[model samples]
Target chain A: MSKVPADLRYTKSHEWVRSLADGTVEIGITDHAQHALGDLVFVEVPEAGRSVKADEPCAVVESVKAASDVYAPLAGEITAGNPQLAAEPEVVNGDPYGAGWLMRLRPAPGALAAAALLSAAQYQQLLDSEGD
Target chain B: MARQTPLFRLHQELGARMVDFGGWAMPVQYSSQIGEHHAVRRAAGVFDVSHMGVLDLRGARVREFLRQLLANDVARLKTPGKALYSCMLNERGGVLDDLITYYLGDSWYRLVVNAGTRDKDLAWIRERARAFAVEVSERSDLAMLAVQGPEARAKAARLLPPAEGSTALTLEKFVGRELGRWFVARTGYTGEDGFEIMMPAADAVPAWRSLNSLGVASCGLGARDTLRLEAGMNLYGNDMDESTHPFESGLGWTVVLVPPERDFVGRAALEPLAREGSPRKLVGLLLEERGVLRAHQRVLARDAAGKDAGEGEITSGSYSPTLERSIALARVPAATAGRVQVEVRGKLLEASVVKPPFVRDGQSQI
Candidate 1:
């Protein structure tokens, strides 16, 4: 089973969000998503200043098996992308929740409250329901 | 539920990622697909090919039956233990399945066919064997393992019985010999020196474990596919099917058109195709970009005037671990030039057309 960090909020699509003290939020695919994708070879992160809606695809992650879209958990304006991924995409498979963070976003006024992001416990339960 | 091979439990024990392949619960990879692929090319790797169908044909006129049933001339197998690769075709000259037939003795021959096409191939062979009084029997009691690479033969020979090990070491390419309860063949699909061993199903796990102990890496179907594709070997369903013929699938060499006297199953349909020349031909594509190439991607060919010449489809494509580049096998117009554009995820990327076997014997061919 993959680790579900208790500090982060998650989406059913597998994206995780970490709200910063400055009102900005950091986002990345969860460990479960990375494990499913397997050995990331390429990652297309969203650019800064781009607006994304909740549940909309904002980035792409590709592995040897297939390519998958990374959706935004809540509507926001992109602040910055992880520039380090262009050279080394395998970081997503290694430290998915930390240095492998996809982007930083400035959330819309009511987006975080309106978005139905699941808690770490809720995400863990969801993962358990998807039995091997 | 998918069928499980004799080594299924062993695969699970080894932490292989299992997948449903051709109705069989087979390992797609253990740790990494690229790692397994490199192991096979650089050293040695063992594959559980037990899901492949094995059939034994026995009759006074077995040779005659195969001569009519297979596109390749089985009569060429005058020497015992000789194997021939051929395609079984439908009446319309379309390929039904590609297989290997080994002439074991005067009246006995063995065939290895694709796992997915097992039922259909058996039914077709049985239906045709009736006239020749040949008995087609499926050998479900056996399992197959392909130990492939530069050092594959020497490493695997150490595990066989003494006398059998010596015989296996001396076996020539494309030849099989029965020793004790095992049948060892000096043949492989990875474009490497290796042995494909067939033994009792009960011995699969033990033999796999023994080979693993000898520093042979356990490979799965994911590596098997990439290795074969790099070797320019065709996957039955991907490279050709009922709608495609050998002429267009880069398998014209497998078809025996000589002596004109012998008539094979699809010879009637293939005759005109041979004379008139096929409009489409299979070619290799080398991607010049960063992205990976996959099957079913559209390929656009252009003429000298920059106008559309023809369109093609990638039959099999992947990021070749050996070359560290994306490569593919595609069916395109015979007149297609070196340069073509492949539409990948809405972006047209330029690619170069080259002869296949992109990497063979751990060396790049293109």
Candidate 2:
């Protein structure tokens, strides 16, 4: 299983969002998402300062086997994208919740997270259920 | 409604995300495909390749039968454990299946072929074998696992009977050895050093757990595709079917016509194509643009006329883990080279033509 920190908030699309004090939320794919895509090779993220709605395709993760999109977790304005990802795509595979973070966004104050998103415990439960 | 390997139950327990691959319900990824792909390149990764068909071709006249039937000469396998890769063709030179024939001696040669093409390959070979008084039997009682990577041999060697690990690794490439009930071949799909182990059905469970304990990552079919693509190996149905010739599929060397008097199936048909040269040749495509290439994608190459008028297609494509870029192996007109463009979903994508085996020993050939 991918490392899912209980303190982190996750989107149903399998992205973990870490909220910063100044309102910029650091974004990265969840352990589940990375595990699903397999061997990640190339990643393309949206430019910083762009506006995006919740669930919008803000980035792309290409694996040696297939290509997939990284969906935004909430209605927000893109603040930054991790340029380090271009040089080290597998960084996300290694430290998905840390340096593998894809992009940061400034969410609208009082706007709620996507309703369909799951908690760490819930996501782990889903994973176990799938095995059965 | 797909077939599953003998180790399917174990794969489910390991959390492999299964997918339909050529009608087999196989794991596409276990944890991360990229990690597993690299594991084989750097460390070790194991693949359940039991889905590939294993056939025992036995008869007194087997040598003569195979020499006349296969494009590659089987006599080279005079050493008992040697292996040969060749295309079994029809009378018109159409491929029935690309298979690896292992010389087991005593009128028994073991052949392994693609899972999807097994039925057709068996029927065709059996029909021809009838003329030479031979018998073809599919050995479903066997299972195969490919432990691949730079570290694969070392890890697998440790699992053998005492003092045999070194011997297993010492076996030369294209050679297989029978140790107890397990037959291990130093051949693999990944362009990395490893062994493809064929074991009896009963021993699979114990072996799977043993390898897992040794830190060999359980890789799924997803990494296999990308690794093979980067290695410039051809997928049977994608690169060539019965209608496509071996010469056009970048495997002309596998065809050897010796003695100047031997006649085999498709020799007459291939002779004309060989003399006149192949119509299309398989080329490696390195994407100049940032996008993933896929199979059946049209590769736009200029005709020999050179006025920008010809058509081609991508037989296999994927993101190359070793190169960290998307690449493809395409079959196009033989004379066409230099820079070529692939039409992927109505978009013309630029790709460079490079000699294949794009990645070897975990390094980018480009």
Best prediction by TM-score: 1
lDDT of 2 at A83: 91
Work out the TM-score per prediction: 0.96, 0.82
DockQ of each: 0.46, 0.47
User: Alpha-carbon error at A132 in model 2, in Å?
Assistant: 11
Candidate 1 lDDT for residue A20: 96
Residues B1-366, model 1: lDDT tens digits: 999999999999999999999999999989888788889999999999999999999999999999899999998998899999999999999999999999998799999999999999999999999999999999999999999999899999998878879889989999999988899999998988899999999989999999999999999988898899999999999999989999999999999988798889899999998999999999899999877778999999865566677999999998788887789999988788768999988889999888988988889998
User: Which docking class does model 1 fall in?
Assistant: acceptable
Model 1 Cα displacement at B105 (Å)?
1.4
Residues B113-205, model 2: lDDT tens digits:
998888877887888899889999999999999999998988888889865777897899999999878899999999999999999987777
Model 1: runs farther than 4 Å from truth?
A: B303-307
Worst 10 residues of 2 chain B by lDDT: B302-311
- Model 2 misplacement above 4 A: A1-35, A45-60, A69-132, B163-167, B302-309, B344-348
